[model samples]
Target: MHDFCFAIPYGLILMTGGVLGYAKKGSTASLAGGLGTGFLLLLAGFLSLKAFKKGRNSYLAMILETGKPVFGYRGMVYAQSS
Candidate 1:
């Protein structure tokens, strides 16, 4: 139910897709976009998990999980709009 739970899996999926795209079609864009976004999400997920262990929330993870709005301000709104 936590953000990290989804973010981690999503990140892994993105990363795998990126690698597959590059391997199957040599698409640099896909590789870059997928890998970059995936890495950010994965890092954010880890941060969230760490915070959860300490009984805290990770705004950074929440922001990234929601499409990573500017400075995380209005992230939920942006996510909804998108």
Candidate 2:
């Protein structure tokens, strides 16, 4: 539910761009681009949710939830605090 909630809006924006491109120039490439981008974002959101489920207190999730940079490493990844 959480992943879907985030993915839907992102997908809608991309889909709208694709529709606009098609309307403006009738290019199939524009339509494809929009669909591709939206799908990628949706996938990313779903993956993030899975990560959250596995590690509710994971460093990445903490930083993302707090909307702030956190220093130190979670495995090989490090975020520089600001």
Candidate 3:
């Protein structure tokens, strides 16, 4: 799936454009846009990292507690009853 494939590229472009605009034209809008976007990216990264750690910890806990593998598809949890 090409999901989220363009995120980084577009983010970089926005940042570069912002810097260029701020440097060449001295536009406050450009500076604000870059700062805002940078903040958003940072937030997204933080949230994603948190989510990944949470999921990994949960999976490991489940495996250790149940001694059975857990499975899921498309965010749907499937617990196998032993």
Candidate 4:
């Protein structure tokens, strides 16, 4: 699911390129630019996901160490007295 979320933007970009290629009567430059944009979008999304995961793990660790509950759809951990 996460991977699909990441792929959607790039897929849209590539689709746009294909459309432009047909529209421009098969211009190679337009196709190439579209591919490039798609690749860059994928790369950016990958990096963002990596950063977010790293930050989330660190935050979870902090909360656990402080004995605080981490609440979400995930299971809750009740805080323990020091």
Candidate 5:
């Protein structure tokens, strides 16, 4: 129902995946992508959650969540190119 509801878990998953990837394969890319995007998602989630509590919406959170797909797509494209 709310962006924060999903974003928080998704962020945590990404962060965990990244750490695991690095640990298993020593992939800096995975670590960077996971931690970086995960942090952003987490931040956005919290921001939106905070705003929701105040009966307001956070455009920043919306923007970040909306843009995540694009960023992930780009990451895939970049990985393929390399």
Candidate 6:
């Protein structure tokens, strides 16, 4: 289940590139476009995953340090007065 979360995007990008590559008349431009799109998608996915992990770690640390949840589903946090 967790693995699929990562695998799905790669699979979709590969399939999309394949389709685009095939649609073009075997020209260099088509191949280039497909490869470029695939590369950019991969790069974006990698960066997003890294950011998500970092954010989750930061949120967890904040919760531990503050001894309270940082935000609710509604994106509101209660402030405590010292």
Candidates' TM-scores? Answer: 0.78, 0.48, 0.45, 0.44, 0.93, 0.42
lDDT of 6 by residue, 58-81 (tens): 333223223322322123323332
Stretches off by above 4 angstroms in model 3 are 38-82
Error of 3 at 25 (Å): 0.5
Q: Best candidate, TM-score-wise?
A: 5
Where in model 2 is the C-alpha error above 4 Å?
Answer: 1-8, 56-82
- Residue clash pairs of candidate 2: none
Select the stronger candidate by lDDT from 3 and 6. 3
- Which is the leading candidate under lDDT? 5
| Tens-digit lDDT string for candidate 3 (1-82) | 2212333354466678778889999999787767556444444444444545566323332232232112213223423332
If both were scored by TM-score, which would come out higher, candidate 1 or candidate 4? 1
Cα RMSDs, all models: 5.8, 10.5, 16.0, 17.2, 1.0, 15.5
* lDDT over C-alpha atoms for residue 10 of model 2: 76
Question: Candidate 2 vs. truth: CA RMSD?
Answer: 10.5
Ranking by lDDT: 5, 1, 2, 4, 3, 6
- What lDDT would each prediction earn against the true structure? 0.84, 0.59, 0.49, 0.51, 0.95, 0.47
Residue 63, candidate 2: alpha-carbon lDDT: 38
Ranking by TM-score: 5, 1, 2, 3, 4, 6
